[model samples]
Target: MSPPLRIALADDQALVRAGLKALLESFGDLVVAIEAADGAELIAALKATPVDVVLSDIRMAGLAGPEAVRCLRRDGDGTPVILLTTFDDSTLLLEAVEAGAQGFLLKDAAPEDLHDAIVAVARGESLLQPVATDPVRARYAYRDQDAPKANFNEREIAILRLLAGGYSNKEIARSIFLAEGTVKNYVSDILDKLGTRDRTRAVLKAITLRVI
Candidate 1:
């Protein structure tokens, strides 16, 4: 038989952690390897024991969930993370995903949804709650798909995706085999086409428009 998936739980609230632990344990395929009160504790625990997945709260006392994911990613830890949040903030969702979280779930999600999310995320799938889905769809609903596509070609889309990951122009150039100046020009064109003045805004807009 396959070994149970090890999971780490990180939430500021003791009661919430207890409840989540209980619910997760109810699924025989999952095992809680570590429990932490906040993202800081989670980060520390991660250094000790490798887990199959991390379920973390978005807003914690220190080192919020997204930041923890970012830190882990920076440290070359590719463990899947599922961020939990009380509020369905679109900006937060985007930030969490951009930070390398595999899933974003609301605190009040159904037990089955949580279980399925954990399973899916641990297997390299992504999950975003409906609260984020509606807004994203509504925002893109008015786009004219039949109209001529924006001038962004394949290479520009590749560069924009790297930019969204917070890579520098030099790094992006290295990634796509282009000169730094060429990458800079592409970035400028991307910003102009997306109607954003800066790289951060360009990424956010691209995410909003599902361009990257």
Candidate 2:
């Protein structure tokens, strides 16, 4: 039989952490390897033992979620990190994405949604909470409606198209014949103009606004 997906969770609230542990354990194919109360503990736990996926709260004591992600990436750890947040602030989401988080999930997400996200991230897929989807779409829709006289430029439109196609910055650069740094700059500009947080939100917003 295949090995179970080893998992780790980090959250500041003890009750919340326990609840998540219970929910994750309810899945027979997943194993909870460790739990941390904060980002520092989470990093320490990771150093002691590696896991397939790390589900972490974005706001935590010690090192924040984004910082932890940066540390992991800097250390060349391939484990996927999923940021869990209660708020839908676009800035936080964008920062986490720029920090190299593999997935973003809302704290109120359903157990099944969390499970699916974990599985998807474990399998190298990006997962965005469904709840965030519509708001993102709405942000883009508002932009499009407000800009009846003007539309996204060719490069911006191309970037949006590639985003909808699930291309990361590196992939988009390769496909569009642009430097990775240029793609990153465009993504930042896109988020700024569309008023969305992350690439996932940008993609949904682009679709709703018909910008692509």
Candidate 3:
């Protein structure tokens, strides 16, 4: 049998944390390895025992969720983080994306959605709440006026088009008969040229610029 998914929970509210823990534990293949009431405790737990995923509230005592994510990423920690927030502010969402968080979920997201996000991030896929995506796209839509047209060659354009079509990196590589690493490089170039931080943002910028 496949090993259970090891998860860590971090929130300032004890009751909320416990509720989330109970909800998550109901899934057969998920295990709550640790729980923290604040970001400091969360960091300590991470240092003491690593887990496959960390679900953290965006607003936490001490470090806050985005800062904690930045610290982990800077330390080269590969464990994915799923940020939970109550606010639908696009600024916070963009900050989370830039911090390398694998998933962004609302505080009221369904338990099943949380479970699926954990599973998806564990497998190196990004999971963003569908309702959040539109606002995020809108935030980048106006940049097209100031940004230059992408300087991509035909191959790069092909890759960006696939990305805009909602294809994952691996799927794009396969469709184009290119190595995954090659596709990743192309994506990096696309992001650089488009002045965006991530795949979703890049696609949105491309659409706004009419480049893809």
Candidate 4:
């Protein structure tokens, strides 16, 4: 069998953190290797000891999940993150994902959803999910395919898949043998075609449209 996946977990309430730790560990092949009460501590602990995935609360007394994720990605840490939230705040949820989280779950999610989300991002696939379908999240994300066909060419489709995998423009350029500037221009066109402002939203729409 493969080694168990290591997870770094962060949440402000000690009791909540402990309960979540237990629940996560109860799932075989997963372990909470690091724990923290807030985002700042989570980031510090991660810098000291990296893990396969990060499961963090979206709002905390310090740094907050979105800001913390922004910091990690800014410093070149590509570790995938799945954020948790109790509130049904679409704005905050979008902020966290846009800041580089691989996915987010409502704090009340069933154990299997949590387990599956962790495994998905750990394997470099976008969860774009939580197995228990959340209605509030449904409001802003993943509607029926309504976009007019983007008619993306083969190259644009390839770039969209890379974006879903969270590749940076430079990384995508290197992978496809194009200049970074050219990749950026293509991304801009993709966003325009999809009517979204950022790559994360673009990918979400692409998935909804089944274009990627």
Compute each candidate's TM-score over C-alphas: 0.65, 0.65, 0.70, 0.67
Which window of ten consecutive residues has the lowest lDDT sum in model 2? 140-149
Put down candidate 2 lDDT per residue, 1-212, tens digits, no spaces: 88889998998889988888888988887888989988789888999898999999999988889999998889888699899999967656666766888788778877877887788678775654433445454444364464331457889888877766545677789998999999889988888777767666566566666675
Error of 4 at 180 (Å): 31
| Candidate number of the best TM-score | 3
Stretches of model 1 off by over 4 angstroms after superposition = 132-212
The true-versus-predicted C-alpha distance at residue 44 of model 2, in Å, is 1.6
Residue 71 lDDT (model 4): 92
- What's the lDDT for all of these models? 0.78, 0.78, 0.79, 0.79
lDDT of 1 by residue, 102-161 (tens): 778888888987888788677654566644444554544435442223667989889877
Candidates ranked by lDDT: 4, 3, 1, 2
Better of 2 and 3 by lDDT: 3
Tens digit of per-residue lDDT, candidate 4, span 101-157: 988777777788788778877876454432222433454565444565547888999
TM-score of 3: 0.70
lDDT of 3: 0.79
- Model 1 residue 56 lDDT? 94
> Candidate 4 has what TM-score?
0.67
